[model samples]
Target: MSALLLDTAPLRSSPEYRRLWIGLTLAGVGSQLGVTAVALQVYELTRSSFAVGLVGLVSFVPLVVLGLYGGALVDAHDRRRVIVLSSAALLVASVLIAGQAWLDVGSVVLLLGLVALQSAAFAVNSPARTAIIPMLVPVEQLPAANALGTLSMNLGVTVGPLVGGLLVGTVGFGPAYTIDVVTLLVALVTVLSLPPLPPLGGARKAGLASVLEGLRLLRGWRNVRMTFLLDICAMVLSQPRALFPAVGAVLIGGGATTAGVLASSVAVGSVLASLVSGPLGRVHRHGVAIAVSVAAWGAAIVAFGLVLLLASPSAAHTGSVTSTAVPWASWHLWAACTALAAAGAADAVSSVFRQTVLQSAAPDWARGRLQGVFIVVVAGGPRLGDLVAGADADALGEALAAVVGGVACVLAVVVLMAWQRGFLRYDARDPVP
Candidate 1:
C-alpha cells in the first residue's frame, strides 16, 4: 500500500519545493477562477459561441511564440528570476482583467486582448517552472514529482470552475477576477522565496539564434521528440473539450449546469487518478505507459460519444445554446460525466508519464528548451484540436464527430508507435533521451 501511494520524497527532500508546490496549487485555483469568469463574461458580452471561440484563437499565437522564446530565456538566465517576472506579468494581466470587469467595460475585443496577454505570461511562466522541477528533485523521483504537479493543477481545475460559476452567479465577474489577483499575490511571494537557479554553462544570449538552437536540440533528441509527438497525437485526436458547452445543452439535456458539471468531471477524475498513482512511480516502461494511457483516453471518449448518440434526437438538439443553467438530474447526464471522468483519469496518467520521461531524459542544459517545446505542444495542440473537433462537429453532429475523433486518436497512437520503435521499447530503468 505504501508503494502504491504517491511518493512524497521531493517535498520531504526540499523545503523550497514544498513551498513552491503549495503556492502553485493555490495560485492555480485562483487562475482557473478568472478563466471561467472570463469565458462566462465573454458569452454575456456577445451571445455568440463563435465570439467565445475567438478567445482561444486570440491567445494561441502569443502562447506559441512566447512559449518557444520563453524556453530559450529560461536557459539563458536565472530560472527563479524568470519565473518571478513572469508571475508579476500574470498578476498585472489579472488586475487589468479585474479593472475591466469592475468598470463594466462592454468591449469583447479588449477582453480578448487581456486573455492573450495572460496567455503569453503563462507561456513564459510554465517552462521556467517546469524546468526548475528537475533541478529540485532526483531523477528516480521524477514520476512522483510530476504526479504531484499534475495533482495540484487538476485540483485547481476541478475547484476553480465551481467557484468561478458561483462567484459569477452571486457576486459577479469583478469579484471572481479580484479573487484571482489575491491568489496571484500568494504565488508571487512563494516564488520570490525560491533560491536563485542559474542555468549551467552553454546558455547563449536570449534571441533568435538561441531559440533556433533550442529547436535544433529538440529535433535531435529522439526520446524528447517522441514525447512531444505522442502528446500532440493524444491532444489533437481526442480533445473534444471545446464541445462540452454544446454537449451539456443539447446531447445531455441539461443547460449550463450540465456543461459545468461535464467540464469539471474530467478534473475530478484527474484528481482521483493522481491520489492513487502510487504504483505508477514504480513502473519502468514510461513510453509504453503513455501510449497505453492515451489509448484508454481515446476509448473512454468513444464511450462518451456513444452516450450522446443514444440520446433522443429531440433532447440532443433542443435547448438554448447559451451557458445559462437548467438543473441536471438525468441518469444519462451521470453516464456522460462518468465517461468524461474516465477519459480525464487516463489523460492524467499519460501526462505524468510523459512529463517524467522528458524531465528524466533531458540533460540539465537542454531541459529548459525541451520543456519549452513540451509546453507548446501542451498549449497549442488543444487549440488545433478545437479546429479539428469544431469542424467535424459542424459537419457531422457532435456525437458522430466525437466518435470519429476518438477512433482517429487511437489509430494515431498505433501509427506513431509503429513508426517509433525506440519509444515502444523504452525502459525507465535505462532511459535514453
Candidate 2:
C-alpha cells in the first residue's frame, strides 16, 4: 500500500524542492482564482460570452509569442534571477488588476490588457521554474516530483475556481484579486530563497540565434522530440472538452451545472491518479509508459463517445424536467463521467512520464528552451483540439466526432511508434536525449 501511494521521497530528500512545491501549489491556486475572476468580470462588464473568450485569446497570444523567448532568457541569465524578475512582473500585473477592480474602473480593455501582462510573465516564469526542478531533485526522483507538480495543478484547478466564484459572488472581484496578490507574494518569497542557478556549461546571449540553437538540437534528440509529439497527438486528437456543453444539454439531460460537473470529473481523476503514482517511479522505460498511457487516454475517450452515442436516443426527452432534475442518477451521465475520469487519469500518467523524460534526458543548457516549447505545445494543442472537436461535431454529430478523434489519436501513436521504433526502447536508466 505504501508503495502504491504518492512517493514523498522527492519532498523528504530535498528541502528546497519541498519549499518550492508548496509555494508553487499555493500560487497555482491563486492564479486560477485570478483567472476565474477576470473572466467573470469580463462577462459582467460586456455581457457577451465572446468578450469572456477574448480573455483567453489575449492570454494565449502572449504565452505563445513569449514562451520561446522566455526559455532563451532562462538559458542566458541566472534562472533564480529570471524567476524573481518574472514573478515580480506577475505581482505588478495582479496589483493592476486589483487596483482597477477596487477603483470601479469598468473597462474591459484594461482588464484584457492586464491579463495579457500576467500571461506574458507566466510564459517566462514557468520555464525558469520547471528548468530549476532538475537542479533541485535527483534524476531518479523526477517522476515523483513531476507527479507532485501535476497533483498541485489539478488541485488548484479543482479548488480555486470554486473559491473564486464564492468570493466573486459574496465579496466581489476585488477580494478575489487581492487573494491572488497575497499568494503571489508567497510564491515570490519562496523563489527568492533558492540558490543561484545559472545555465550549465556556459551561457548564450538570449536572442533569435539562441532560440534557433535550441530548436536545432531537437533534430538529434529523437526521444525528447517524441515526447512532445505524443502529447500533441493525445491533446489535439482526443480532447473532448468542447463537446461538454452540448453533451450536458442534449444527451445528458442537464444544463450548465452538468457541464461543470463533467469538467471537474477530469480534474478529480488527475488528482486521484497523482495520489497513487508511487509505483510510477519503479518504471524505467519512460517511452513505453508514455505510449501506453496515451493509448489508454484515447481508448477512454472512445468509451466516452460510445456512452454519448448510447444516450443520444433520449435527446428529445432530456429536456423534460425529470431528466434535468435527477440527472445524477442517470446511468448514462455516470458512465460518461467515468469514461472522462479514466481519460484524465491516463493523461495525468502520460504527463508525469513525458515531463520526466524531458527534464531528465535534455541537456541542462537547453532544458529551458525545451521546456518553453513544452509550454507552447501544452497550451496550443488543446485549443486546436477544441477547434477540431467543435468543427467535427458540427459536421458529424458530437458522438461520432469524439469517436473519430479518439481513433485518430490511437492511429497517430501507432504510426509514431512505427516511425521511431527507438523511442519505445528508451530507458530512464540510460536517457539518450
Candidate 3:
C-alpha cells in the first residue's frame, strides 16, 4: 500500500535532492506570502482592481524575454551559479518591497516595477531549477521527482495565502516581506551547497544563436510540442477562475467568501491528487495520460457551469448569506466546490505527465530552453484565459461562458489528439524527442 502511494525513492536516493526540495518548499511558501502582500498593498494604495490587474501586464514582457534568454544562459553556464545569482536577485527584491512598506512609501508604480523585476528573475530561476531535477535523480525516477516538485508547489499555494492573511492582519506587510527574505536566504544556502552543474557537450555561449537553437529543437519535437498545445487548450479555453467573483455574486450568491472558497477548492483538489500520486510514477503512456486528464478537466468544467445554470433563482439572489457564515451543510455550495475540486484534480494529473515528459524526452543540452518556454506558457495561459472568460461572461452570462469554454476546450483536445496521433501513443520507456 505504501508503494501505491507517492514514491519517496528520490528523496531517499539523493541527499542533494532532499536539501533542494526542502529549501524550495520553504521558499515557495514565502513566495506565496509575498504575492498576497503585494496584491493587498496594491489595492490599499490604488483602491482599484484594474491597478492590481496591471501587475500581470507589467510582469509579462520581462517574463517572456528573460525566460527565453535565461534558458539559454542555463545551457551556457553552470546552472548552480545561475540559480544562486537569481536567488540573490529575488532576495534583493524582497528587501526592497519590505523597505517600501516600512518607509510608508505610497508609490504603486515603484511597487509594480519591483514586482516586474522579481518576475523576470523568477523566469530565469524556474528553468534552471527544473533542468536540474533530472540531474539529481535516476531516469526511472523522473516521474516521482516531478510529483514531489508539484507537491511542494501545491502545498505552498494552498497554505501561503492563509498565512499571509494572518500575518498582514495582525502584524503587517513589512513582516510578511521580511519572512519572504528569510525564506529566500535559506533557499540560497541550498543552492550554494549544490555541486557545480555546467552544461554537457561543451558550453555554448548564451546568445540569440543559442536561443534559436533551442527553439529549433523544440519545433521538431512533436510529442513535447503537443504537451504545450494540450495544456494551452485546457487552460486558455476552460479556466474560469477569473470569473469566480462574478459567479459568487450572481450565480453562487455567497459573495466574496464564496468566491474565495471556489478559488481555494482547486488547490485543495490539487494537493489531494498529489498526495496519492504514487501510481502515476509507474504509468508509461504519458501522452495519453495527459490527453485523458485534460478531457476530464473539461468535463468537470462543463459540469460546474451546468450546476450554476440550473440553480434555483432564489438561490442566485441570496447574497445576504456570506461564505464564512455558511454551514458545511449547505448542499449547493458543496456541490460547486466539489466540481471545482474535480477540475483541480484532473489538471494536476495533466501537469505531472507534462512535466515528466518534458524532462525525460528532451536531451540535456536543450532541456533548459524548453523548460523556459514551459514556464512562460504556464504563467501566461491563465492570464489570457482571464481575458477570454471575462469578455465571454460580459457578452453571454457567466454560466453560458463557462459552458461554451468547456465545450471548446474538449473539442480542441479532440482535434489535437487526432492530428498528433504519435503523441497519443508515445511511450515513456522509449521516448523520442
Model 3 TM-score on a 0 to 1 scale: 0.87
* Model 3 lDDT-worst window of ten: 318-327
In model 3, pairs of residues that clash are none
Please report, in order, the local distance difference test score of every candidate based on alpha carbons.
0.80, 0.81, 0.79
Per-residue error (Å), model 2, residue 318:
13
Ranking by TM-score: 1, 3, 2
Candidate 1 runs further than 4 Å off: 46-49, 312-326
* Candidate 1, 1-433: lDDT as tens digits: 7776777888899888898898889888998777667766765665444454566667777888999999989999999999999999999999999999999987898998999999999999989999999788777778888999999998887888767766765677789899999999899999999999999675568888878888888667787788888778778777766566566556665444455567678889999999899999778888889889888888888988888888654544445434444445667778888998998899899899889888877888877877788888987787666656766777787788778888888998899888888887888888788
For TM-score, the strongest prediction is 1
For residue 16, model 2's alpha carbon misses the true position, in angstroms, by: 1.3
Clash count per candidate: 2, 0, 0
TM-score of 1: 0.93
Question: Which residue pairs clash in candidate 1?
Answer: 4-278, 5-278
lDDT per residue for candidate 2 within 15-49, as digits (tens), equals 98988888888888888777667756764565344
Q: Of the candidates numbered 1 and 3, which has the greater TM-score value?
A: 1
* TM-score of every prediction relative to native: 0.93, 0.84, 0.87
